[model samples]
Target: MTRLRIVLADDHPLVLMGMRDLLEKDFSFEVTATLDSPTALVEHLRRHPAHVIITDYSMPGDETYGDGIRLVKYLRRHFPVPRVVVLTMVSNPMIISALYDAGVSAVVLKRHNLNEISAALHTLQAGRRYYPPGFQRDGAIDARNKFIGERINSLSPKEYEVLRHFVRGESMMQVAESLKRSIKTVSGQKISAMRKLNVQTDQELVAFCVTSGIFP
Candidate 1:
């Protein structure tokens, strides 16, 4: 029997090492590459084919393939063959939903038992989607989170980009410059995003972004 080829990526060295060791102990898995950044993962995937990829949801350093949904989308767009499983600590239902929409095969919360990783892989092999325990419970999603998630998904791409930049600590002027839009235009986009998110102040916006794990 052929061992499953896998690539593991995480910004934290310890987490990356532990995951590699844990998966390698299982006779069925062969970890082909362990990468620390989105760039390295993409570079490695370009030259080598893997059966599966397990990567962190938030790896903050790479500017080209920013983390979270964007990174997931990039991976799906460039390498559609490999099954992508995201490892994240985020519990936000909205963000998790977005990840699925971005084409992730599964999401394994960091706080869950490491064994879930193996289970996720097996579930995928069986031609089914894997969700963490309680993912389907009605009580798992609150009214407020559902509302916020719906509203968040409604933001236009430009508005979403403005809010993302703001959450990353960029000033309106800087965001405007980076996006090549005028300050007034950028400010309008920010306000529109805030309204859509139901945030009344910049602090509130930042707090929502942090708590919701949307910009992570």
Candidate 2:
């Protein structure tokens, strides 16, 4: 059996060390290189390509390859052969969707049991796509709607409260009064919620809430 060669990239040093230990100690996988930034990882890849690349979705880079979708796109385009596995704290559906479209072999959420990484690797070795557990379950009727629901779920409790009031036809000031929060606080929460859901306008945000069943 040919041993799997792996390359790793993450911004945090501790995370990089921990991942290397896990892969080498128990899995007996050969970790060719461990890097602290996407830029360094890309450089290492150019020098030494591996059978698989496990990377954090967000990593510090100078400008072009700084983070998220851009780095993922670069790896898929440049190397193309080494299967890509994203280990990330980001659960944003839109970003995850972009990674999938960019041809990532698997996505393992950092919050999930590390065992999920094992599962993702197994599936990838078999030539199948692996998502965070339960992402594809329940036979979701519409992918977009499902993603919207997930984005909503990612919001903070206060953010969700502000958004709920706005969806009920309340103005930002009105929501502030009802929630006993200052207008500025309510507005901030609303803005944060909108950013998380990737909506630019109040109308669009409320429409998303209604469509996703968060507002009825």
Candidate 3:
């Protein structure tokens, strides 16, 4: 089997290590280079071509190539345009839409499990785009802003995790135990998620979850 040549770019050491480990262990990839900053990434890419580039949008870089949209645009314009998989902590719909417009093949939230990364890479390899559910490359302007109002995409990673347990009918205590967090912390995250979803009561929250298909 011909291994797919891949490049990784992230500022966080732990995240970079974790991603490298996950890709090497679970996927058919050959991670030729792992770069800590956009400068290094650009430098490496100038000398070597890769099949895919998995990068974090908010990593350290130069003024021109500094992370987020600028770096993505740089990659799109300069390189041969390898399949770009964006693993980011930013869940803002506007920024994500910009990434799609900038030629990002897949956008995976860092909060999601490695499975999402695999799914994204598969989709990109098959010549398709991968956006989180409820997000479209070009949707209504109001709909884009309202996405945060109705979708979990507005929630922080931790809050999203808490909501996953809450929708599964888990109590705050159970959720805390399962997540190895304090009950108070779990409750706070759940409440925060609810606020982001614009739900003021438990009944409304559960209804939202059910209607959103977050719960079976």
Candidate 4:
């Protein structure tokens, strides 16, 4: 059997290390690298592309940046053969939908039953898409609705627009330019949106949206 070469990336040290150990212990996989940042991981992909990329959806310090969605999009856009699987604790529809659209092979929540992730990897190896064993069972229709509803109930249109750009790791100036609105307009929208979203800081807003799956 040709061993499937892989790389694991997550901002959390323990989580990153644990995932590497788990994959090595439980499967016929060869992990080529484990990285703490997406920037370094991207550079690694440039040098030595792996068969798969197991990435967390969120990064602690990076908040909106150095995250899995953008990283996966970048990998799919530029690299060869490395399929991405999101292995994180976030269980939100916006998150699910965003990662799904980002071209990941799988998006497995960090359920206590992480064995599903192992299964997802094997399924990917066989040229198939994998969702967690009970993603549907676990997150019933109501739970999914709750996430979407939260976004709907919390943010206004302009705030939502700011969030769309913000979640994808865009700068405030970039958001202003892209929306063709003034920085003051963008700044006001952001502040209002943050209040509605119930977040005090921009970093928290990004994390909330990512966790909620509202931001790309």
Estimate every model's Cα lDDT from 0 to 1.
0.83, 0.76, 0.75, 0.72
The segments of candidate 3 whose C-alpha lies over 4 angstroms from its true place after superposition are 134-216
Clashes of 1: 0
For candidate 3, list the clashing residue pairs, or say none. none
Worst 10 residues of 4 by lDDT: 60-69
User: What lDDT score is found at residue 70 in candidate 1?
Assistant: 72
Rank the candidate models, highest lDDT first: 1, 2, 3, 4
Number of the top TM-score candidate: 1
Task: Please list the residue runs of candidate 4 whose C-alpha ends up more than 4 Å from where it truly belongs after superposition.
Answer: 60-65, 134-216
Clashing pairs in 2: none
lDDT of 1 by residue, 1-216 (tens): 557899999999999889988888889889999999999999999999999999997776576676667778889999999989999876656667777888999999988999999899888878888998767454556898877767777776667767877787888997776566799999999999888888899999999888886764
lDDT of 3: 0.75
Please give the lDDT score at residue 126 for candidate 4. Answer: 84
TM-score of each: 0.77, 0.64, 0.61, 0.68
Tens digits of per-residue lDDT, candidate 2, 60-103, equal 43354645555677898999989999998755455566678888
User: Model 2: residues >4 Å from true position, as ranges?
Assistant: 137-216
